[model samples]
Target: MEYRIEKDLLGEIKVPKEAYYGIHTVRACNNFPVSGLRTHPALIRAIARVKQAAALANMSAGLLDRRVGDAICRAAEEVAGGGLADQFIVDPFQGGAGTSTNMNVNEVIANRAIELLGGQKGDYRLVHPLEHVNLSQSTNDVYPTALRVAAIGMVLELSDCLAGLQAAFQEKEAEFAGILKVGRTEMQDAVPVTLGQEFSAFAEGIARDRWRLYKVEERLRQVNLGGTAVGTGLNADPKYIYAVIEELRAITGYGLARAENTVDLTQNADVFVEVSGLLKAAAVNLSKIAGDLRLLSSGPLGGLAELKLPQVQPGSSIMPGKVNPVIPEMVTQVAFQVMGNDQVIAMAAAAGQLELNAFMPLIAHNLLQSLELLINAVNIFSEKCVKGIKADEERCRRWLEESHSFITALTPHLGYDRAAELVKKAMAEKRLLREVIIESGLFTAGELELIFTPGELTRPGVAGAKLLEKKG
Candidate 1:
């Protein structure tokens, strides 16, 4: 490919003639090739929006020429609208605390702007990247603000996915309302609970996750877009600072506000930690739910066998007719990944130095990945797994009757000692609690049927007490 020479402070470098990215991006590619992953598309669009807003704000402040601002805004819009996506080539892991990312965007926008103005791509004379496109902006302000924007968008998407997942569980809850199953604590049968009740708990967890994820937007909406360098608004004018956020709000349609204390917003990375912590909490819930699904669906012949997940594929190469709970397993793995990303985000946020966090790139990368992964995983789980689950009503009934734990529910009617003695007798005889209770002749099968109704089985506190009261 034909190449063009671009000069920076570190001398001349050759860039592809057709490439919008220039010297800084090339240097970044060379310096940080650790992860071949490029910056997230959401973040790239967010940065373009920041650049567009800065142009409009600077032009309003009379600091940028109208012609230059117009050209830059047009080019920035192209990038923001999803054009020139391949031009953002910098790796997610880079030095200078996202300066490489900022310059990559700047160079691409400047070159594209130059072309729009009927000038050659390398003609910085028409649209200089740093002098015109990035006027009144700093990496410190631009990068973090863009991260906030992208994160808010991702969080909204994740909330929607969570809502869908919750609905899936709600549907299953209604479907399995009549399935009486044995509940276990510490791998031992504890009590009888309807399969619907178990699914209702899953739905409740996802509902909580959705609400918590939605609230993160409130924290992310406050940003330091014009607090150039160190958040003191040192190089950026006050008018530009105020106008920039307004332009950003209008462009992105987010309820964004400039932080009252830009320095605090700039220097501290605690918000990212808080966001990651919330993500970790969501991950925890997802992991637990996934594990429970796996456990419930564990065996067609040898395990709990209480649930049957949709068989999307064959499970084993060696075993015949084997199918697995692959979707919940997938959800479990994604949860692990999100949880790991949270740790990375937490540590990166805490590793920032004074005046400016030098680890913003690391934090942004992990946080964004976590959001994207969760959005996709939760949606897939809802669509493919939760929606397709089938409860084995017969199996549920058998397990509930076989376990002595069901005797606990009869304790209010039978005295505690009698219940305990009956449990031992049932175990010793290898008979079901229902059989032993029937033999005792304290109540008929018809009375036991009324006592163990679906609502009565799972409802909290003294479930069958009224049966004995009526008998008295």
Candidate 2:
């Protein structure tokens, strides 16, 4: 069968019509049949760094033809400027250690360069994907380099989103400062705490996770791009490594350094695994926060009744006026998926055996997917949940005032035996602990009030309720 020819800007490159069935390539030919997702902004930036590194490496080694080097650099600029970025499409998921992805970029750049010179795709008889576009590079080196660049970009955005979430919780902290609620352990009321303190704990957890992610970002800055195929730099000049590292640093504004042990770099992808693990930890924390929100907002009149979440959507088709903590629920689901993806990454990293890690395609897919989901989840949680949360102040106050658990605070003053007896009587008779204490003649009304100031029980102070505060 004669293959139908599609002319690329380069000239006439013939892709087996059947081979273009991959998601990215097919989508590029279909939806963006006219244009694509505009060459992922992160990818465009990465390719620019790749070209810059390639040019610097070639120049330092006296192997660069000035004319071809100039053309490659120009093409890189055009791609970076969003020209032809739409032409490259290889599924973010693929095998071949991202060779398909690398080739997609190479083809687009080469084709665009050919157009600049009045040629066509596959007219690469002059400027070729392997010859000029990929000089001194292998998928082993280039693929990981691009992944690092893209991961760094994602980390930056994720960090910003996390900061926004932290700020949202912090604001809620101040807003709910005066509202007290029952604190629970093992799903049972254990003590008194202000709603503000609860939000602050959530914010602190996120802050710690954000710092961990930032630390992981540093690992991505040390790329193994100059390692070439087997990490021996077999076909590359010795000086190329240093030069490429310098150029990449310049292009990316990241503190990119060459791997000290390129051979180990080629053999182990534990770095990616570590990053995914950190992300999993963050996701777990997000899940915990979401779980708390769901539990606190479990029912408006039937459950804990301590806090209220913002209503983002209707909770039921059959039960009108029911609002669910859907935002947190979605965040919880994203967290679970991210956690599972991290396990997949760990297994893939462990599966790396001989000289080359062949599981990078899966690693990249998992990492990218985790980042996208986490970023979106953080945005939704902050916007729809944290920022919109309201304390059920009256309900919280009533729970605190009516709780028999508060009698525990009086133990230090009345002796444990007396306090226990009073608590038992209050629970048996279904009377308020305060009323039981006053009626039993354990304490006068003034002394009872002094011993049971809810604020002091919630947060310790030096005055009226010191013993109660200590017990709490």
Residue 335 of model 2, lDDT score: 98
Clashes of 2: 6
lDDT of 1 by residue, 284-310 (tens): 899999999999988889988899988
Going through the candidates in the order shown, the clash numbers are 0, 6
TM-score of 1: 0.98
For candidate 2, the 10 contiguous residues with the lowest summed lDDT are 18-27
> All predictions: root-mean-square deviation over Cα?
1.2, 4.8
Report the C-alpha displacement of residue 290, candidate 1, in angstroms.
0.9
How many clashing residue pairs are found in candidate 1?
0
The regions of model 2 sitting more than 4 angstroms off are 1-13, 16-48, 78-86, 460-472
Top model number, lDDT: 1
Give lDDT tens digits, candidate 2, residues 379-468: 988987888787888888788777766766666667788888887888899988888878877667877666555466665553345544
TM per candidate comes to 0.98, 0.88
